[model samples]
Target: MRRLHTRTARRRVVGALTAGLLCTFGPAAPALAAPAPTVAAPAAADVAPTVDDGLALTPPMGFNNWNSTHCRAEFNEDMVKGIADIFVEKGLKDAGYQYVNLDDCWALQSRDANGKLVPDPVRFPNGIKAVADYVHSRGLKLGIYTSAGTKTCNEAGFPGALGHEYSDAQQFADWGVDYLKYDNCNNQGVDARLRYTTMRDALLAATGTTGRPIVYSLCEWGQNKPWEWASDVGHLWRTTGDISDNWGSMLSILKQNLPLAQYAGPGHWNDPDMLEVGNGGMTDTEYRSHFSMWSIMAAPLLIGSDLRDASDATFDILGNKEVIAVDQDPLGKQGTVLSSEGGRWVVAKEMKDGSRTVALFNETGSAQRVATTARAAGLPAAGAYTVRDLWQHKSYNTAGTISATVPAHGTVLVRVSTDAKWAKNPPAVELGLDGGLLVEAGKPVKLTSTVTDLGRTAAAQVSVKLSGPAGWAVKATSPAGTHTLPTGRSLRTTWQVTAPKGTPADSYDLTLKASYRSPTGVRAENVLPLTASVVVAPPAGVSSLGDLPWLSTTNGWGPVERNTSNGENEAGDGNPMTVNGVVYAKGLGVHADSSVEYYTGKACETVTAQVGVDDEEGDDGSVAFEIWADGTKMAASGVLSNAQAAQAISADVRGAQTVRLVVTDGGDGSTSDHGDWADAQLTC
Candidate 1:
């Protein structure tokens, strides 16, 4: 029960790491049970025209219930209807939102006697068709979810469209379904493109009396390189794993999706997952960035929140017509990063109407001021241009140079167009790095990047350098040596980056500085900061944890200290209760709820950690420490009052996972209950 039913696995599978910073557990990676079927290649001849149903020509816009009300369990029909009502009654339709997509778990435990998928009667007594009628009546489209495999991602308690693709497609079209979000899960060993096209064929073959055109959305989580071949198969395709509502995850998705812009155009888009605005994980600034970036990417603007109870801020952010217009821009050209400096990004898109859309994005921790000339952003630099902040709904004047101080994780989205219709030639050279952003703590990963000249002019003296965590032994071939790149040419370079022996499971930024000279002999630089997340998996057998930069992302009262004594933790300082070795937790009075997280490479039969009060305990208080695994508290040190002896707490962590060590003040007003989780070790 400590699995999918409780937590959502948005990252890697269960027995693997329910990653994305410990979201939850899923089934172990599915096995290839048998020889894969000799699936035929995609029907190149028919695939294009079959799904090119003149629909979703501008990136399907809607609200999907899967991300927010995952199986609301009670009255799923009303839930969807409420959103559809909100879309029309609240002006969302006017803003170009047109779809209200429903997800899995809306199915019954059993299909009809004829093996037809049925809506769970208790959840949708009126049936899905009734809800579809309502949504369509409001001039909106209706989308439903299913899986290409045997079951849905949630292993939903119902059959998917795998074996009954024709029947399900017929039923969906008959019921007026307009969109289909096909997930990949529980598939035996069928090739992804094969399975998805099977359903695509199923939907296309459904004609006659129940025949209706449906937009196809492939949600295979991008592991299969969908962009390489999903051109005519679906209206949109997911380009990465799911997105969590946090600054780190959102920024990571932005970086991942930036390079996939080429695959998006008129009939199809590269979805970066759903929007998490007003979800309360990050600040409004971060949500603004998320919304702006998604719009810039031309991604499907699917709201992942309950609109019935949406805050005014959420409503405004989602209903921002100006930003939505940029996403719905008829030009259909997806935005790409124009230039990057550290964590700041300048994204630009060419509009079909001779105008250009630009966004100054900052993902740093504080406000940063970045500047660029109009020519650098591909705009005509003849005279002053009109710049309007889509989020602020205000206009500003800028002549050639456009500058703004953007808050951390915030965006300055604007449209820059002057009277002169001549836009500057594009950048002469662009730099891109390809490698696994997530690195194993002690392993080394070689990175490769390609420098291309997209403009007509040639570039010379091209050079590239990398800056990462100090002393990671990061080395790269000196692209910095003088070199010439002709127009339409590209140069590739490799960099070998090795993580330190004792790196922690956290995200690190690696900044790439690439400089070149234009045809006119002017120098230009593009700073691309790549985020490398380190996963420190516990080694085999039993081993002592080594020294790492231990800082808590969420602060409680005190800090998790190492061999050095923690003096100021308590009022007088200087008493880190290190029991047997180097690691422990210390706190201040009246509080101290801190936790330490680690990744064990393999399954561990047992884990042990010593707990004790700080050696400098002065008053009467109780300290309680606990060890948690798979979302369950496995062991505890009850309530220790004295600081003399260390108590041993052990837990059976039979699988490789993220183990958490938590220390608290025993529920009472923390007096001198400075607690410590000392010398934690794992036995595999």
Candidate 2:
């Protein structure tokens, strides 16, 4: 399934190459399937109990060492103990985190002559029991990993507990192991349920002797529909495959886990793999969204970053107690989707206190206002409801409407309840732009930001200010401050913003902040951030777009390549840019959900390109290409497959300041969706 034990650089490269080869399957089916209909819940008496070991009543919150160190030498007993120490010192333990879990590669290649597992001396010199005792001393639990197959997933092929389930379980019990993350790898054709159940019985028998319950985590990669049968076998079963630390990977896992809410409850969960919060593969905003969605789905909160050297931003995200509370709610209910349309999603989870935590998520490339009423979020009717913004840690009283302008790949999480104390914090303000604004470098543009008071109270000292990066100029054309902003009233402020000449092409944050005082004299503030891209005008004559630098780019795999086809899932691994037996000298090669933008300076007329699934994918891959001018879709290539010829695209870009080349997985998951823009040209 997911092998992460390559010790050498060459082996890592080979692993990437092998993944690329595996992606060369037949064309994927249409991606646009109807969303799963929400199923009504059964009565408490009708529901069957799950692995009732009294462990992991909520999804496990802990640290797993697989995502950061893999099989590196740095992953030793000292590192594990250090993680435990950090858990306590850094307030993670106080934040409800436990279990210092170790993944594979901690065991020896072969068992001893007594048929007992042996810890790697280099990795655990004092042995597994010593590490467990140390973690226990720190008031945390200890978890160890092994596969159900004859060997583990790592390249070293460490001994597994397949035929030795009882013996291994007893050994773990003797070592005071508190959790067992049993994986599926080289399973020897055994049935998943049978194998996992064997471990379940073994653990139970072992607990009979030691009187210590071990939380069982089943990591089978969802190949066998574990959620349908894993409830009685393990505490948490992986609902999808392994997760990588990227936006696309996280989004894919979220999609896979969102619809399986009915299968989760007390003592059992549908895990979408571990958290990649500080893995460095995604931006902080995206990581926040990742953590938010997982908490909404009630998945495990196992930290996957190296705690020994994590950033403060990462800790801030992981340490968000409000978000963690949603995951650890005593009700043990997974969130159900309220609505999801056009990359905007609203999900709500019911808490033990009769409150609902609603998440407004934006999955598109631009900021959009996502809205849902309190009723839609399953909140009861009241005179007014306290809307607690979990991310901003602000509270406001809302009559019914709950909305926010969410940034691209961002989430606005709020808890709706009748709690009166929440009403004392502030008033809710909705922020938005008059329309999409795209400006050329060195050019001044007037943009209007609308601030609407959606709360029950009027706001005094209301002021709106727009700010950009250094070297950029911003001046408000309207009044900078007002005496009072009544409820349901909106105040508009226009600001003239100018990007400095020769500004590099990149996406910059332009924040619109509104500050006011509530009726109770509480200082309330709201900030909405949107991206402003600085674009470069095309040359005087027609030129290959690949020859020009882009404002920004996002690819599903590897780095977007210039003048080459997307090769293996690594940088500089692309082949010659080719499609349908035709080779082009210049263009971009990218994966699905990829977008590359360039400034046109409102001078370019027509943008033309030959687009299709890259020939490297053979007869596989399905994708659609679109040309976007400013914020409008100028042209689109309806779902094209690698089996088809290249499709020509020509979009009118007259009076457009920026142009974007976009590739999407054709209504399906982004598997083998290698797309190319061959001979892309911009006519100025």
Tens digits of lDDT, candidate 2, 361-401: 99877788899988888877776789988988867887678
Candidate number of the best lDDT: 2
Deviation in Å, model 2, residue 193 alpha carbon: 2.3
User: Which stretches of candidate 2 lie above 4 Å from their native place?
Assistant: 1-50, 420-423, 435-437, 540-542, 567-570, 577-585, 598-673, 680-684
Question: Which candidate comes out best when scored by TM-score?
Answer: 2
Global Cα lDDT for candidate 1 = 0.67
* Candidate 1: residue 7 Cα off by (Å): 7.9
Angstrom error at residue 212, model 2: 2.4
What are the per-residue Cα lDDT tens digits for candidate 1 across 1-684? Answer: 012432224223432321111111234344555623433423455343556677678988998876666655743887888888999998999999998998777887567899899888778888889989999998999999887655555534356566778788889998899899887665555677878888877777664335578889988777677888887788888886666555545665677789998889988899988898977766676788889889989999999878888889888899999999889998898998878876678998888776678888986543455556668778754645555558757443444555555654678787766643212322334456765554676688888866765444566788778779987878875454457877657677788888887886677778777688765666766555556767755456775432433222211332344443323223334444554333354322122344555555445678776667655434334668877764468888887865457787888877635566666656543333456555656676
lDDT of every model, 2 decimals: 0.67, 0.82
Candidate 1 stretches greater than 4 Å from native: 1-50, 207-211, 420-684
